[model samples]
Target: MIKRIYPQIQGEIESGEDVLEEYSRDWSIFKINPSAVAFPKNSSDICTLVNWASLENKNGHRVSLTGRSAGTDMTGGPLNESLIVSFSRYTNKIISIGDKEATVQPGCYFRDFDKATLRKNLIYPAYPASRDLCALGGIVNNNSAGEKTLKYGKADKWVKSLRVVLSDGNEYEFRGFSGKDLEAVMARGDLFGRVHREIFRICTENKELLEKAKPKTTKNSAGYALWDVWDGRTLNLSKLIIGAQGTLGLVTEATLGLIIPPKHSRLAVIFMSDMKEIAKVVDICMKFKPESLESYDDSTLKVAMRYAPEMLSVIGAKNIVKLAYDFMPEIWRVIRHGMPKIVLLCEVAGEDEEEIKSDLDRLKANLSGEGFEVRLAATEEEAKKYWAIRRHSFALLTRHAGERKTAPFIDDVAVPYENLYQYLPALEETLKPYRKFFVYTVAGHVGDGNFHIIPLANLSDPKVRALIPRICEEVYRLTVEHGGTITAEHNDGLIRTPFLNIQYLPEVINLFEEVKRLFDPLSIFNPGKKVHGDIAYAMSHIK
Candidate 1:
């Protein structure tokens, strides 16, 4: 019975069946199976497995608890059935490093915390292009961002405090305070001062309806960032548990906050062949404020040149005739300008290397005086093959989709960059009747008018799993009519938590179910993520 009531849980508590089928799949397309996984080895073995799953849910039993790490959650938010608690074997660690901050341990590894913040040159710039296979508890529960988050932004703006564990199993810590240290943390009466006096009285009586329910895009990890916790001068419940995917609890340490990049960088690479000139080349690459714009299409460069030597282990390419002689100038620009339906990439940094090559020669002469073509990665190994095809084109369509898979349901949508010239052509005419049932890929972080599409399908074809909620209700109703954000960095797990009221409202999803009953009042964490998700139990747990 859970190792005789958590006999000081040192770790490993399996329930076999190949550890519940490897904790029942993650990079989402749900599979669920958990029923005992536990591997904690710290935070007092996660407060004795959340006090033995809150005393096996006060005896009635269907107990819960999810927390996982490096399961690279694409939004199954560390899938759960009951009790999973992984934290990368022995709570990974790094636990300290300063001069701007570090702290670590949510099963560490964002490529080992970006090689320990680049040996003190400092970083942790909101990593995520599955930064060499995620962790740091899925980049602080998926508040993750990528391609240098178009100038450092997500992972809850570089965290800076957490620790967590709640649902009364204890372990507090959080951060951010203000005037009179937020009234001595809401007059410490306990349970972390009634969860900081009822999340500071539900964010000061819904401060202007949570600042008009934020998310005008440019990054959001679906719901319960309770409008970034009381902004009228600091209250920060670690900004609502940094993207609450762990469902308001089980964090187990993290501090973050770091920077110090730019010593000079570069990379240009455009190549459009027109998709209505991607909002006029993202409005002239936002007047050269680039620090990563990124893109990918042409069906992810024809599935990374039909798995060109399995992308020689992600753009390091030492073989396959030096990766087909470095993609022979993109196979002679697809036999002289023919296949480029999109391939941006921008980048641009500085501390002055001749003003980063005169801002990439005036951003390739204002994208060739608007006639467009551009191409400037003169090295950094020609910018690692456009970041190895924008970070391995969704792991090369989940390993050569011969019998399809990678269906990240409308994967991370995001809008508002002046409504991508009328929302990317009404989202490619609302997925043109599901492109005859599958085949997709578009990629993202184009300076934050995010995208990610994915698709691939075949979910053992139950009519292509009944067109995943009618293509997530026509691409989240055209991404909330272009104001966008139905996840800009993968978070409303189990498939966009039953479509968060198609991008919130209804009094901000009833104050996100009263901030999940004021911090899990017995819902026992990570249950159908971000408030009661269902869509027929997430489409009968699609796989």
Candidate 2:
């Protein structure tokens, strides 16, 4: 079948074990060998392939397609038994850079986009943990957010427009609709027009319910971000597609919103004894409106210490103090002497240095009564060190887990910011029964009340594997009880799809299905993900 369609596409298409093996699994525990892999060089190439896949073959089966970026998705979004459209290999290119926006191919790396925007004195703000490795396509698809979520917001906030291709080969550039554009959309009789009309109707009809269901947390990337489309005025169709995880359609090109780079920035690390004090510090840091606030538990820091030197060497020591610490063994004694059980890392930034210092001063004054030790990163390198602890903590856990691997099943749960004190303790107690089998560590973007539980379980053991559903159930129950989201920034792929109904109302889930059908009638694009799948399907394939 691929050979039949090969003449139409202007890119590479291959099958067999060697090609199939590359697209089999991603960073997640799930693994499934795809039937074939297609490397489409451009949007036209994608359109042809999508149209071919949508047609019924001799076997009366339409080939399914899944757009892949980086293949570093931890939720099994890129794991499926279908034709993998490997976007990152050839489609990675920054098309254009404007004053406050940049149009880029979906395959462009987040770091590369950041570098390109930084050169123009602008920035694309959402920085997930996989900032360097994750591509723009995956980030947008997942609506991923990182430490800066509290301030800069998620991928949805930065997406200005999208050039998308539907499963039936129809191409459309989605952007915010003006009154005139909305009228024009409603008047058209074409497929794109019909899509717009249905979306507009859904957005308008369910405006109140959508707004009410919006999570109070700082970020969310769960089932279709339908609520973000209608803002009381014009409809922003791009927001709906931003976090659909490629189940909606193939996002070939994206014009991203950018912000002016901050002229000055300062990061501070605060140490507290327990969750209560850590929560208090977070409150104070939030009041200061830091760019991002991250938290690391004692277990996280201690684990990070095991890999600190190696990470420091990679980050590079620019000053004598850092150089001495790198070369001198005695420096560890002083550093380890006052390490606290919990740490909160915060960053404040603006164009003015004095204003940032004043904010830092105010933050310190507010935190004085908490008995917390505040350490301002004196140099940029020191700041990077503080941030690295939060950035690379997950990797450290995975590296140190020797025989076991870090399972991300219940890792990105988030609750209301005020309920962190209640959620963390309850979550810890919930996992107590399986503690003997799994070694889990907690770290997260604390300002937004989101945290990750890096559970190091030997997945090969049947007993350990059986406990996954129970662990997920307890954690999700606690999250819902606290008015939190099952997934804060990571979109619901195979991991959280079954639980999506638990998060939203039945009507909303129905609407999600309708939306999926409206865009992808054949369900060939990344099937068995998000809105319509069960956890058993995902759990069964855990490898």
Among all windows of 10 consecutive residues in model 2, the one with the lowest summed lDDT is: 325-334
Per-residue lDDT over 1-543 for candidate 2, one digit per residue giving the tens place of the 0 to 100 score: 545654357888778777787788777778888877888989899998777777744346757889998887888898778688989879999999999899999889988989888988888888698887789999888888988888998888888889999876878889888788788987888877888889888988998888978887778888887887777677777888888889989999998888887889998778776676556677778888899898888777777666667556555545535543642331353377554667888899988999998888778777876666777777776678767667777766766777798888988889878888787778778888888998877888888898887788899888988888788878888898899999988778888888887788999899999999998888888998877887778778888
Query: Which residue pairs clash in candidate 1?
Result: none
Over 4 Å off, model 2: 1-7, 57-59, 316-339
Worst 10 contiguous positions by lDDT, candidate 1:
1-10
Q: Cα RMSDs of all predictions?
A: 21.0, 2.4
Q: List the residue pairs that clash in candidate 2.
A: none
| Residue 140 C-alpha lDDT in model 1 | 85
By lDDT, the best candidate is 1
Using all chains and alpha carbons, the TM-scores for the candidates as numbered come to: 0.35, 0.94
- The 0-to-1 C-alpha lDDT of every candidate, in the order given, reads 0.83, 0.81
lDDT value, candidate 1, whole model: 0.83
